[model samples]
Target: MNADTRALLSEAFAIIDGIPDDAIRFGAPRSIKGPTLDDGTVCSPEGWLAQHPRFIERGLRLTEDGSAILYRGEGSASVPAALPMARALGLPLDEARRLFGQREEFTANPDNPLTDKQLWEQRVREVLGKAHSPRAEVQELAETGSLDPHFGHDVPL
Candidate 1:
C-alpha cells in the first residue's frame, strides 16, 4: 500500500481506538509474527504487517533448523477465514487486546528469532521444510543468522 493509504488507515484506527472497548468486538491492533529488526528486535504485529500489504494476505509460516531460517508467506497470505486462525497457532490474543484496548495487533507472538540462527535453521529445514532458492531473500535472511529453515525444502546436498 502507498504511504498515503497507510497513514489514512493508521489515523482511522487512532480514531477507532478512541472508542470505548465495550462498543466493539474487534478493530485495529491485531497480532501477527514478523521479521526481526536489524538490532535483533522483533517487529510488533502492527509494524510487521504494515511493513507490506502482502503480510495480511499471507500469514507467515515459521520453523527453525538451528542454523538457516526458512520462512514462507514473505509475500501473500492464505485465504481469509470467517474465524480467526492465529489462535489455532497457539497465539494468545489477549495480550494484543490488552495493549490496544479492544484493538487487534494483526500479528502474533514469537515476533522474531532472538538470535536468528542455528535452531532457526533446524526449524526451517526440519519444521517448515522450506528450501527456497539459496539466492532468495529468505535464504539471505537464513544466512544472516536471522531465520532458521525448517519447513522449507533444502537445496540438493
Candidate 2:
C-alpha cells in the first residue's frame, strides 16, 4: 500500500479501537434506536465510521449494505457496513467489504469466536504486517529492541 493508504488504515484502526463494545451492534448500519452517540444506540463498524467526527466533518454518510433495495421484501437491508470505511480510507468497496466482513465473521462464528479486542488486534497486525519491510523490521528490532514501533507499548505485537 502507498503511504497515504497506510496512514489512513492506521487512523481507521485507531478510530475502531476507541469504540466501546456495548456501542457496537452487528448486522445493521445503525440499530433501530438510531445513530445517536448515546448509550442506547448501537451501530455496526461501518455505521460507527459514518458517525465518526472526522468522517462527519468530511460529510460521510451511512447506507445499508444489503440486497433489500433490489427486491421489495425478500430480505431485510442489512448493513453494508464496509462502505463508509471504504470511502473514509479511500479503499475500494469490495476490498473494505472483504476486510471488515472477515472481522465480523471472527465474532459472529458460534463455534470459535474472537473478542472485539482480539479482532481489532488481528486486523491491526495485518495492516502493520504490510507496513514493515522484512529486512528493515529485523534491523529495527536489533537496533531498537522492538519490532513494531507504532505500538511498542500499546499493542502486544
Candidate 3:
C-alpha cells in the first residue's frame, strides 16, 4: 500500500475503534422473531445479512453463499463474524449451527489472546495490507473526496 493509503486506513481504523460498543447489535445465527416491518417483510435472522453491504463498502465481504462474512482488506483475512455474534447473543456454537445451518469454516480460535475489538482491528490492518484492486479504488475515491468518511455506519463488522 502507498503511504497515503496507509495513513488513510489508520485514520479509518481509529474512527471505527472510537465507535461505542453499544451502538452495534451483534448478529446471532438464530432467527429473531419479531413483528413485520412497515413494508411488511418478516424480520428473520437472515434478514440481518442485509447489513453486509455497508460492511462490504468498508472492505469486508460476505461469503458468496451468504453463510458468513469476513474482512477482505488483507489477502482474505479470516475474521469470522459468526464467533463474535455467537458471543454477543450468548449462543453456543452448536446452537448457532443449528440455526444458521453451519458455522463459517474460517473461525478464530476461542483461546486466542486477543479481545474481539483487537481482533477486528488486526483484521482491518490485514485487509489494508493486501494489494487488492478494490482497496486501491477506495483509496482513490477517498483522496478525491468521493467516498464518505463514515461509510461504515450501521456496518456489523
Candidate 4:
C-alpha cells in the first residue's frame, strides 16, 4: 500500500485494537477447525485478534491453509458496528465501506501472496482520493441525527 493508505489502515487498525472488549460483540468462528492458517499455523481466533484486533467485529474464518480471513458476510452486524471506527477516524461511511470492500477483495484474490499488504495500496489510494465531499455530508447527517436512517442510530457514529 502507498504510505497514505497504509497510514490510514494503520490508524483504523489502531482504533479497532483500542476498543475495549466490552464494546465488542464477538462472533462464533465460521470454521470448526479453529484459527489455523493455510500454512498450518495453529492460533486461536482471539489470539490472532490480539495482534490484528481489527477483526473482532469484522468476523474471522480460518482458510483451508489456516490463515484468518476477515469478512463481513451478508446480514452481518459488523458493517454497522464498524461505523464508529470510521467516525473516530473522521472518515465517511462510504469511504470506510470502500476500504473494507477493498480488504475483502484483496483477501479473496488468489493470484497474489496472502500477506501482500502493499499489493492493493494503489486501489485503496484511488478510492480514498476520489472522495472529498462525502465527509461534509456525513458530518451534516451526524449533526442532524439523520445517520440513523442510513448507518443506524444505535451506533455512536
Best by lDDT: 2
Put down candidate 3 lDDT per residue, 57-94, tens digits, no spaces: 54444443334444442322143454433333334545
Q: In candidate 2, what are the lDDT values of residues 110-156, reduced to their tens digit?
A: 54465554465465556558555334434533365432223212221
Model 1 earns a TM-score of 0.21
* TM-score of model 4 (CA atoms): 0.29
State how far residue 127 of model 4 sits from its true place (Å). 4.0
Candidates 1 and 4: which is better by lDDT? 4
Candidate 3 matches the true fold with a TM-score of: 0.28
Provide backbone clash counts, one per model: 65, 1, 3, 8
Candidate 1 Cα misplacement greater than 4 A, ranges:
1-41, 44-51, 59-114, 128-157
Task: State the C-alpha lDDT per candidate.
Answer: 0.28, 0.51, 0.39, 0.36
Models ranked on lDDT: 2, 3, 4, 1
TM-score of every model versus the real structure: 0.21, 0.58, 0.28, 0.29
- lDDT score, candidate 4, position 45: 23
Q: Write the per-residue lDDT of candidate 1 for residues 1-157, one digit (tens) a residue.
A: 3444333333323322322333222222222222332222232223323332233233432223111111243322232211122222222344223322212233244353332222222222332224422224444444664332221122111
